[model samples]
Target: MARETHIEAYDGPAGGWGSAKSVGRYVLGEGAPLRTTAALAKQNKVGGFACVSCAWSKPRDPNTFEFCENGAKATAWELTSKAIDASFFARHTLRELEHWSDFALEDQGRLTEPLKYDAASDRYLPIAWEQAFAEIGAELNAIDPKAAVFYASGRASLETSYLYQLFARIYGTNNLPDSSNMCHESTSVALPESIGVPVGTVFLEDFETTDFIFFFGQNVGSNAPRMLHPLQEARKRGVPIITFNPLRERGLERFTNPQAPTEMLTGAETTISTQYCQVKAGGDLAALFGLAKALIALDDAAAESGGPAVLDHGFIAEHTHGFEAFAGACRARGWDAIERGAGLSRAALEQAAETYARSTAAIAVYGMGLTQHRTGVENVQMLANLLLLKGNIGRPGAGICPVRGHSNVQGQRTVGITEKTKLAPLDRLKELYDFEPPREDGMATVDACEGMVAGTVEAFVALGGNFLRAIPETGAMETAWRKLRLSVQIATKLNRSHVVHGRAAYLLPCLGRIEIDRQASGPQAVSVEDSSSHFHGSRALVDPVAATLKSELAIVAGLARATLLPNPKVDWEGWTADYAKVRDAIEATYPKVFPGFNARLDTPGGFPKPIAAREREWTTPTGKANFIFPESLDENPDMPAPNPDALRLITLRSNDQFNTTIYGFDDRFRGVDGTRMVVFMNAADIARLGFADAGTVTMTTAADDALREVAGFRIVAYDIPEGCCAAYYPECNPLIPLWHHAKGSKVPAAKAIPVTLRAAG
Candidate 1:
């Protein structure tokens, strides 16, 4: 049952509609089982839409057909009837769509007009959305609105990211830069510094009263496959789950639930983690300091045999403060350096601290592999010091969860699309739009890629992503997005960041929350928040192959009334055709966490935002609830001296890929069929590097001034972990280097690099 890995052609990376798999079988062909049984009977109902992939949390049930399998390839890559119009741009030519392949530039679908990027007939011409908002308000009023940045994409909406952060702070500039500054900006900078709420204290009936789930560096079966049916219904109600990851996923080891019909007619599959622990790549702060020094040696042997006292002492002495400086930094760390920096063993961290001391409602749940590392905000302050040492935040099935990966990236940071300068979101943007927003620090996707490679960025705009191929220095982000001077995006399809061009690009074309936008104050309803802080309302069930598109909240209220009007006091043209006036300006800005956010997104299973109803009270700045003692348990903060003839490499993801979406090229859980430049190795490093298990190799990098090499590669030998080795992610993202990040989430901790094999030459 392992021969089926066909790949007749699959060009990687592109706008994610469930990121590639033969462009979701050519945009969901054969009527993807009747359009996913009529769009999973309107998931999270009260108007449907949302599941454009990831950010798990739904149940507003119109009838819950419960989507998954990358939410039916993101609703068949946006109900694909594939378009691209304008005679495929009068026969392609942005240098032949830059030699087409980022999955043939989004498998040439949608996007009907509002083009621009001419650069003297290199192509893409069709303009006129009022001449693309008067040439983006004359190149953003001739730059210096803090060099015009703006970013956003977590699939926008929440009234187009609260009117594109209220037109980039009313034309001043808090830059906004998003894609959660390249993934979960460390859970909004470590759960609001440990719980005055950044987000996720757990809800979704806290997985039906959880008993233990931990999980980390999340992979949730190809990234949030409907969170593998609530961890397979909390492992069929016995609950355990565990996992930590260094790749060994299959939706965390088995899944199926094709919305169950006798488990999809007996193809049966539900297994989900009952302990998996691999932990290494940036050894999650030495596996959360070896599970807090094995729960402080099982709470000092249950207080020297006087039974009952494995911690939570009366909810950590009334909702915790600092537990004696987090139990003296987990007793100044030891136990053979936490079992040699968490490669696991203090008897498997005391069997994961006796399943977290017989959990009374545990959770943890993390993702972005624990927030793209370098101690991603000290790993969300050690999962809020293991859920406040067992009092488990706001209870009813314990908390911490992070997950989130678009689908309104936590409702575009719950309406603000941050770059963090909040004083109650700048005093609720001076009481709902009088002005005065620019308080300071903006630009965060690693300081907007070092401010577009240090040229003090000039006009980026995005709104919907694919930003320089989801950035990480792919050839210095295609030469700093061809030296932008106006890039713009607001897309619906055609990716490679719209054929890389920048010196004045545009592309516009919007509308796609599954369609039906309509406008002139009629059938709309957008919203989208997920990953627990619910929020809801989406609508659009199709129909709109371009009535001249436009509805990323009316193209951010027609480019914020062509860059903030001469007399604009926030009616950005009636909040772009009324998105309930951008939910009354995010309910006058975060009213106790978006209270009654648009009448609780018009009920029936929508609302929920307020958090930690009462637990680890911490919005940080020492309101106390922090504990992350990192000095060193080095999960390769650039591991080097390990050249016992090379072998570290890690990079993964390939159950028919998703991030950098390559849908086709069968990875069918590593029995790898078609091809993605193979390379798994570990048959004793291919018989001591003499290679032959399936021939063809070359890999490189042993550091010491070495940049990279990654030539051809075919070596097979499977079952990883010897000196470890696996590859697949931006096709080994050219053997990861862009200053090999992770020191505070610069990210690219591509598992944990090192490399060296050989044999093909």
Candidate 2:
């Protein structure tokens, strides 16, 4: 079935709405509408449920949707009243479920009964909560503590995250493989090195005041729909937004907000970016370096004219270190190198730099697109260096914003789900639970995959995630996970992981955040922090689909009780009955940081956590901000000299998709429809390959030993640079080698993949 890239036809924009509405219907199985609902019943109250979409904070203002398109989808998914009990499981075997599409499988709705995978039946059978807990404990107790690994998702609540960390520490292992290790690890590794803060310094208000916004490697419209409104507003205010991405995203060009009444009435859309530059995949580093070099030259010229220099010499000298080294590196790089590497001319780069210099405040917002490269950490540091020349960090309307994926991904890490870094929380846990926490470092996401591939890990407890499919090196991870003795998953619905069975696998159904958990102690509220570092309460608004479904807190407690430390000093039962007790433990653990956790929840907007960037505090060794020069801007290896036979391939997501989940087969913005298997290439590339437009094509892995092939793909002409092509991820994921990952974070280089195109059979 090996085939070349081909084009069937274009599916119109309005056509996809039907599909979107269809997915919406599937997600909102059975939920009634209600007005005058309490704060907890409303979607986005400080005391209500957190938006299941982007990490953008909701203002106290009631006008905004508080929910984006994706947020609405997330909320609908959570509020769905569909049920998946033992009867549903009996009707579908694990093997059969394995054959289902990701959307169809998740669409089957919420889990109800605690179930274990039956080898003979190849289906999950219902088990009592007590038995499930006993089995988990017995399995963990039999295995070496070092062999057990804890996998966490970003969807976990703050209380659950804290307790999970404590449980792992007391259990004598620090193998916390969290979602952060996959997405923003580069930001975590680089920001501290450059500007003294790992998170964004700009609050939502900063977006309103910034003069120019430089968005590098982010698709804000689809990824964070809330960003579109602000960006549109900025556009209307005549603020320039220069976008540098490998692909010319449709959302970046224009957006018609469905929420805006005027636009909807007139069928009008607001234009977003003033200038769009399509850099080569992995060429972001080069583009950034080129811009900085241009700015430095501008500064020198401005100084000669007796005008204020384009650079903030005072800020650089007072707040930062290593400016000299970075300056030297920029000065040494020639214009030819910059032009060739960045795929942009000196004039184009200067125009971009001049925009930065002229603006009162310039904010650079990025997404996983920046953090998923080989030199991702260095890339982020370079971005910081560019901003520092103009004093962008810790300013009124400027800073670096990393758009985190998953609603509470950042919050999950903030509370405690880290592998090795322990704040004063350990002592508090000791006092509250009478057990010493582990001090050793734990495995990161990359290390976990490596461990599984090496077969040292014998057990994995996945707390709500699609670990195997979500991770890279699917083949290697599957091989290693199959060697494990047990794998336990606490989830609200079915996913690929349940079918990727371990020797002893259990799928423990848990309650969603929107459901009411009426336990022994009465109703409870869970704490969730947003990306902006504001912690608030989440109370269940809807009743659980079935009475048997348990909360994650309850499930973890039952397992802990059944397994190690039968007489554990921690109030596991109390925390399960009421999550506030768990928050009390969190507050006690970090008094200076999380003091008055309960009292603060009553505030209008939850209290802000400590942000070093806000106060311009440097937590580094020198007590001053630092800057380091990356070796080069060429994030990708040099291409083979004038090889007409080779083509560079980058993976992308369709408008109808998010990560591995395909809502439908239409990408409305890209003028694509009814398909996920299309590749975009420049006209010259298609002509050079001797392929006709809209013809069938095949993509084969660049590596000689690899046999991965994506067939029946349609080739379409795009505004892309010559010799570069793009396709959807996971479908093309087989072409990405496990060994090809970022140097610092080890995340897969999905943005820069090498592949060869062929004519289809």
Candidate 3:
């Protein structure tokens, strides 16, 4: 059932009546207009729940309408009038639902009760909470603890994540793989090596004072719309924003404030980026080297001419190491190589470098575009090196900003949800909880998938998220998942992962962020850390969508109690009765970062956690920031060369999509409507490939081994770099092999896959 496809030039600003209308449509379609409106009004407000869409921090003095268009969609989706109970499952068997699209599976409505798969009828039958817990526990006890894997979603709250990690360790396995492994695992691994911290150093207020903002490989408009407000203000105050991406994102070009009635009524739009650079896919390292090369040349000329040195020698000498080696590497990079790799002329890069040299305070903000590659860690480290050259860090309006996707993805890591467990946190948990925590490192997402495929993993439990849809090389991963003895998902709605089950599967419905959770101690609140490391409390304003749904905390506790059968040490029931107890345990675990966690919620906007890089208090092994020198421009040397007709394929999210969730088929910002299977290509590339605009084509991976292909993709000619093409993910995910990923980070190299386009068969 393909809808009518319509393509129109999206000349209007990013957010305006268009956003408002989208929200209205979703809310009305879900039959929750008034409820959605009231819930949205309270979102991001004092003592209100935070938006679960993106990790953008809320303002201290909040606005009346603080939610964005996507935020409204998420809220409506969670609070929809439609419900999926035992009756609904009886109507449609798992076989029938397996053939449905991802959108259709989730749009069927929210899960209302606990379900257990009945193999005989291929349907999910209602199961009591206790029975589900007991059966899950029995399966856990039957298998070796090391054979089970616990996967956590970014949407899980800090308290729930803390409890989840604790449960995994106590059950005698450290195979904990979370969403970070798929997204910002590179940032967590690289930043600490370069700057003594894994998270970004910029605060929310830095946008107001920064002289220049460099948006490298990020789409702020669709991914984080709330950020448009700050960018808009910066534009009004004469801040120059430079964007470097393979595709020109409209969100970074112009934006109209949806919250401003006057701007909405008059159709006034604010111009965002002063310049846009379409760098080649997987060429971020080259572009970064070019900028550094330009800056180094400028500094040398300035010194020879008896002018003030352009480089921040004072800060470099005082707070950083390995400057000479790094400088040598920058000088050695040839302009020809840089230009060829970046797909940009030397003049364009130099112009951008000139802005960097002049500005005293600038922020380099990036998203997955810079991190989802084989050189992901190096990409982040190079950005740090660039900022260090100009002394941009530790200043009021300057630092590195990695805009996070899920609301609490960073927060989950802050709490104990990590594959690499530290001894200090383990000791703290042991001392407080009176149990021996596992000292061994755990398996990350990629590792866990491999373990399952090798028949080493026996059970899989997901807190949230569509694990099958989110991970790359789904064809093999799905086969491996079916080999497991037991599988469980704690979710709010039905997804592809639920239908694609193991030998025995369970679906435990949980309350969403927008729903109220009343425990023995009264209404409860959960905390989430935003992208900037700002910790705030989120409390639900409305009742739970389903009466039988349980909070994630309660579900985790139930599983813990059932699994820890003999002589269990911790009191799982006590923690679930009151969430404050969970916070107290978290404060005890990470005292410095989460000190006075319970009392801090009283503050209007939660406090920003201490960042060592922000204060020049480097906690690295050298007690100072280190400038790392890469050996060459090609980070992944083992990557096979593409065929002459091959184009670098980069997977992107549609304007109406977030991560893996599809709200609609239309990608309005890209002038795409009623379709998600379209690929954007340069007009010249299309002509060279002998393909007409709007013609159907199939994209096949051009690697040495493992042929993967996606069929029936309509070609759309657009403004993009030559030798580079873009398509939506979960659809194109098959083309990315399981072995193709960042070296150390294991994040799928989604931005730099090699593929060839051909006419549809």
| TM-score of every prediction relative to native | 0.35, 0.93, 0.99
Q: What lDDT does each candidate get?
A: 0.72, 0.75, 0.89
lDDT of 1 by residue, 1-761 (tens): 12343432222211122223333464456244466457656755676776777768876543345656556666666666678876787787787787665665775667878888777767788888987898788889987898778887687777778778777887888878777666677776666666677777888778888888888878776677766767788899889878887667666776666545675555566678878888655567777887887887788888999889887878777656777777887878887876666566778777987888888889888877667655677777787787788788878888888888777777777677777676227776876567777788676666776777787887888888676666654666678878978888888888777787789988898877877887778878877888887777778886776788878888877887887766556777676676887787777777776766777775665777767534545656766565555567675655567888787677676665556655456665555666677877668868876778667777776755746666667777776656677777776665666666556546555666677876775
Order of candidate numbers by TM-score, starting with the best: 3, 2, 1
What local lDDT score does residue 95 receive in model 3, on the 0 to 100 scale?
88
- The worst-scoring run of ten residues by lDDT in candidate 3 lies at 565-574
lDDT of 1 at 438: 79
Q: What is the TM-score (0 to 1) of candidate 1? A: 0.35
**Which is the better candidate, 1 or 2, if ranked by lDDT?**
2
lDDT of 2 by residue, 667-738 (tens): 656767666778899899888779977888988766446566768888888878776888886677767766
Candidate topping lDDT: 3
